[model samples]
Target: MTDAHEDHWAAPVAAAALDARVRVPGSKSITNRAYVLAALAGAPTRVRVPLDSRDTRLMLGALASLGARSEETADGFLVHPLGAGGSSHGEPVEVTLGNAGTVARFTPALAALGDSPVLFDGDEAIRRRPIGPLLTALRRLGVRIDDGAGPGRGAPPFTVHGDGGVRGGTVELDSSASSQFLSALLLAGPAFDRGVTVRLVGDAPPSEPHIAMTLDMLHRFGATVEREGAEFHVAPAKLSCPEYVVEPDLSTAAPFVAAAVAAGGTVRVTGWPSTTTQPGDWLRGFLPALGASVRLDEDGLVVTGGSSIPGVDLDLHEVGELTPVVAALLCFADGPSVISGVAHLRGHETDRITALATELSALGADVAETDDGLRITPAPLHGGVFHTYDDHRLVMAAAVLGLRVPGIYVENPATVGKTFPAFVETWTGMLGTGR
Candidate 1:
């Protein structure tokens, strides 16, 4: 991660309790899944309330490069199947994913359905992230993929050669590294002649809720799927694309929820789904444990900050994306905190554990990095220039810290554009800083 920007954001210091109702955009995860399924569907699919951000745009672009016809609609987007007699047939393509894990990992399976070779590559950080397990599974499924990192090796900058279809069948791989790999395979399962059955061979996948989301979406598209324990079976069937409306992004809503807690105020965010597979929905329980009063009423999920946020012992494996916000709150907690079962966070947009510890310590928090988590002891934090490392979550976490502590300048504040393009506007408006 590089600091290419010159100026830093002077994080707003809250003088009084903030009271606001926020409306966050649609889910990036759901939006990307809708796009992938839409491209694979036999007919055109309409996606409603899709998130318009760097990652989701990259997903749409990658699908478009693969011959999927896309058009902007009043609500969201409409994507046509690859069989629309487009230029992508038998035409080799090179798509730059621009640091989107969904585009780099998920698109390869869809690329395997192409008539010719489709090369998938991404930015510096994308190259460093592992994609070996997915590559290995693709090879077992009879897909001819030339691994660019090395023969039989993973990571991006690779090419997938397709005879216009996949010979997908039973294949096993370890998905503990990332649940996205399993979701990617299942996304392209129905198109295969034999469909696909994926069996997890090692530790339980870190975020099983994500896989659940994939299965639910697959089922909604009319695919036959069966799940028993860690194994998933997808039978051959035609996907009937329907009118889809995406839910609000719970993960992206973390910072705003944290703001209400840290600033000692009441904040209600609209469009909270009544039932969903989003892991960030766990925040309803997590916020209260951190010393906040929570309620879910007719409007939305509302949280009121307490006088003193308390420390907690938690296993954040399923909701590791919330670690940064949780860690930030722990810095101001009443006691010490231990966050465990999230070692995989090291492979995220950045080494999150190390980044959190280093930056928090620089701000005067006593942080000890464990093998799989962090043991944070509270200390008096002072103003400092907190580096973002080009990670969007890190920037938001730093911003949360700035609310209580004056003189905190967050470097690379623009990095939040990855998932939340209107992050600055939304955050500033919610904080009532009007910056």
Candidate 2:
């Protein structure tokens, strides 16, 4: 969920002999963004090898609810975009985005073009994430939006009532917080009457590559967008048929590589391209820095760990999601590792940096939290039950930690459903009874 509020359970997982050739999920980032753009374009598009996760599925369901159609085909999916008349039936379209931030933001923006108001709602966690920035952006577009419960409205069950007044205008947003604000505007460009221009009013953004990904998708949709530093320009453009395959997920594969080095085993992960648009692919570089004897072949990756690996000092702004997984690996090395460049992580599923430091320290590793990152001192970890903050990354990081120090228990093990649901079963497939 978005807000780190209310009740949640931790997942318990102990380290096991990890010797699996793991094939992780497709890219969730690419899948969700494309789904919104394709559906709004109202054109038939094919997304190959897409990630079938909770977030992406919520976006897909929103598309269908808005009159778009999707079908399972081959190993991917075929989407048929609907016209303006599709959701004009005057029925309230209820969409439960279930903690998927992409759909929660972009869908309401896209639905503003229809005659019906897109009533957006989500899970308890989604209910907590703030949408003031996006709501401000939409209202600036001349779309009628009721952004709050006001005296009576508060959380989920919020509504975006469209005035059908799509304007091409400039929205000044603070991207230092989230690229989702900019991405939402880009996805809504084709439907806006006056085109759109977004001016970022903060630092160079946390996930720069994700913004690049959004721009690339905009270009693919036949939208005319101009880039001038932090300001992006977009005009009403045609979204022609899109032919694309979803890239493999390097983020999901990071933990396995971490385990390979932590447990003194040799393991390989497949299905990643040597080249990728995802900055998370930088895992190859980061892992090696943590002392995992890493080899990147044209096909995939091979990692061998066990010896004394030195700690690393690094900035991971571009690949923040990989930090927790890599941090667990660093804990097994010889010295302290300092990682910076991810202040925005405090807003993720959990305050990732703080939560990681707490969990790692609880396991007897020396770690300290910072405003923007984490500092870790290498220490032998005696096995203990890990309280996963219901974060998939934490769950994975805990698993990697357990591999190095036995007797690890994970709470809320199901949190991996966001990316890798069959984690224990599928990943354990490789570490069979052999070693």
TM-score, cand. 2 vs. native:
0.90
Question: What C-alpha lDDT does candidate 2 achieve relative to the native structure?
Answer: 0.75
Query: What lDDT tens digits, residue by residue, belong to model 1 across residues 131-186?
Result: 89989998999898887545655877788897778889999988888889899999
List TM-scores for all candidates, in order.
Answer: 0.97, 0.90
Off by over 4 Å in 2: 1-20, 149-157, 433-435
User: Model 2: per-residue lDDT, tens digit, 126-160?
Assistant: 76665666677667677777646553243456676
Top candidate (lDDT):
1
* Residue pairs with backbone atoms closer than 3 Å in model 1 (clashes): none
Superposed by TM-score, candidate 2 places the C-alpha of residue 394 at a distance from the truth, in angstroms, of 1.4
lDDT of 1 at 268: 91
Candidate 1 error regions (>4 Å)? 1-5, 433-435
Q: Where does the lowest 10-residue lDDT sum fall in candidate 1?
A: 1-10
